[model samples]
Target: MKREPSLRERKKLATRAALSRAAWSLMVERGLDAATPEAIAAEVNVSPRTFRNYFASREEAILYSLAQTGPGLLDALRARPVEEPPWDSLTQVLPAFAAAFADQRHIIGSLLRVVDEDPSMRAQHLVTYERIDRQLAELIAERIGAEVRRDLTPRLLAAAAAAVLQTSIEMWARGDRDLALPDLVREGLVEVRAGLPAGAAVRVSSPSPAG
Candidate 1:
């Protein structure tokens, strides 16, 4: 049996979600520059202080809405059954992720547009990417039983994979080009794999280096 979220936890999640929704809605209606934290707090029926408790700034409130998707990706990776290859697990989960993106197409498209137009938001976007890349590297290290380093092979692959996903999502958000997002994601992964040096494989060892 699984435990559900406690009331406090649920309320906290709801408050954050409300803030995110309110921020995006306001940004879409008005421009991103016009969606002040005070305005968003009023829109969500929360005090400005409560809004600050949930988010550090208006930009964080908006970016949090999109960065919240990262946990879903981690959950998808966790849901894969034992004995599945890392690549195969990733491939299987890509469709579900794409579906989620499709569901939020309008909000995501608007967010991307805001990022393009605002320098602060663009910096925030880069920070989000760096966070995701670090998470991906950790996941890859766990899967491959390899030491992860800034310049190590597995870490580089993880960074490349994360980049591919980011690029694909950017392309998808650019316009409705009749191409499926999952197809684009798969193509991105294919390109990532193709770019890796030939015969790259994880090597397992029994002993740790002496301290």
Candidate 2:
């Protein structure tokens, strides 16, 4: 029989989830500037201290909520059968990522709006993207059996991929009409493949940028 999640793990997960929910709700209701950690704690029925225990700051908490979309996408990609190529896995998983945004379009729209309105949020958004790019690079490195380094080749490819993914996400988020996010992701991948040096082997196991 499969063992259940440990009590500690479950509690940690619950606390983080509650904190994320509380932060997002406060952000939507009062805008990011007005949603202080104290206010978020009060909204979540937790003390400010407890809130800090779960998150470093109000901005960090909000960033966590935004970054939560990444892991879900990774999980979907991991779930693809081994027989599938990396590209196929990505194509299959990307729609699921886009579908998530479509599901929470309003919250996403609100977050994007708030970020645009606040310089601090804009900086935080850039940091979040850097963090995501690093994670994607790790995934790519693992797939290609290469180390992530300052070298031009790895860095350039990673940067280009990240740019594509980021642009795609922004387009989908800002569009008046709903976009098929997965399709955009696939198109981006195709572009990446086309632009690579001739005779370069495409590794499907690696993660590509969302822009």
Candidate 3:
């Protein structure tokens, strides 16, 4: 069984999460240049050195909440009954994961735009998901009776799962408010499980030629 976090450990995690949120909020409100370690630390009532102890860079600090997404879901996946289909288990576990994004829903669009505008942030974002992808691959391999490194299936499944989560989040963050994030995630999972066939032709409107 996994060990429960001590009160001290919980406090440290809370501090780290606070720092990450402060960094992101500063970046959104004042731009990246304004979200310095000193500023972020000040927002969290911590010293700059304490911030450094938690995160190595401003980018890492800003993206810290993202780094926790996979592990929690992986734990849920592991606890699922062994007889459940791997794909079904993957799909069913997403609503719980989607709920974690509720706190960010308001600022998610700004967060996406900020990340898109900065190359370093964009790179760090990819790196975060890549790490999740690798860990998820290992879990999927165990579920499917495949080797993590040697079997391509596990890696592919992991990538697809990650893509579903990423795409769902992006769409929910930037698209209509009518569709809830969990519902969006469930829809994406359904499409992915159906092999993402291009079932219907998409209609497009094109600009008229300049006179």
Prediction-by-prediction clash tally: 0, 10, 0
State which candidate, 1 or 2, has the greater TM-score: 1
Global lDDT scores for all candidate models: 0.78, 0.71, 0.88
Error at 122, model 3, angstroms = 0.4
Compare the candidates by lDDT and give the number of the best one: 3
What order do candidates take by lDDT, descending? 3, 1, 2
Question: Judged by TM-score, which candidate is best?
Answer: 3
Model 2 agreement with the true structure over 1-211: per-residue lDDT tens digits: 5489999989988888888787877788877766788888887788999988988777778888667766665566556775565555655566556665656655666778878888878888888878766776666555556678743454555566667677777777778436576677667767676774444765567687789
- Weakest lDDT window of 10 consecutive positions for candidate 1: 195-204
- Tell me the deviation in Å of residue 39 in model 3: 1.1
lDDT of 3 at 163: 92
Q: How much does candidate 2 score in TM-score? A: 0.76
RMSD list, candidates in order:
9.2, 9.0, 5.4
Tens-digit lDDT track for model 3 on 1-211?
A: 6799999999999999999999988998899999999999999999999999999999999888888877898999998998898888988898678978866776878878878898988989999999999999999898889999899998988898899888888888887545888888888888888867665446577999999
Error of 1 at 90 (Å): 2.1
Relative to the true structure, candidate 2 has a C-alpha RMSD (angstroms) of: 9.0
Q: Alpha-carbon error at 38 in model 1, in Å?
A: 0.6
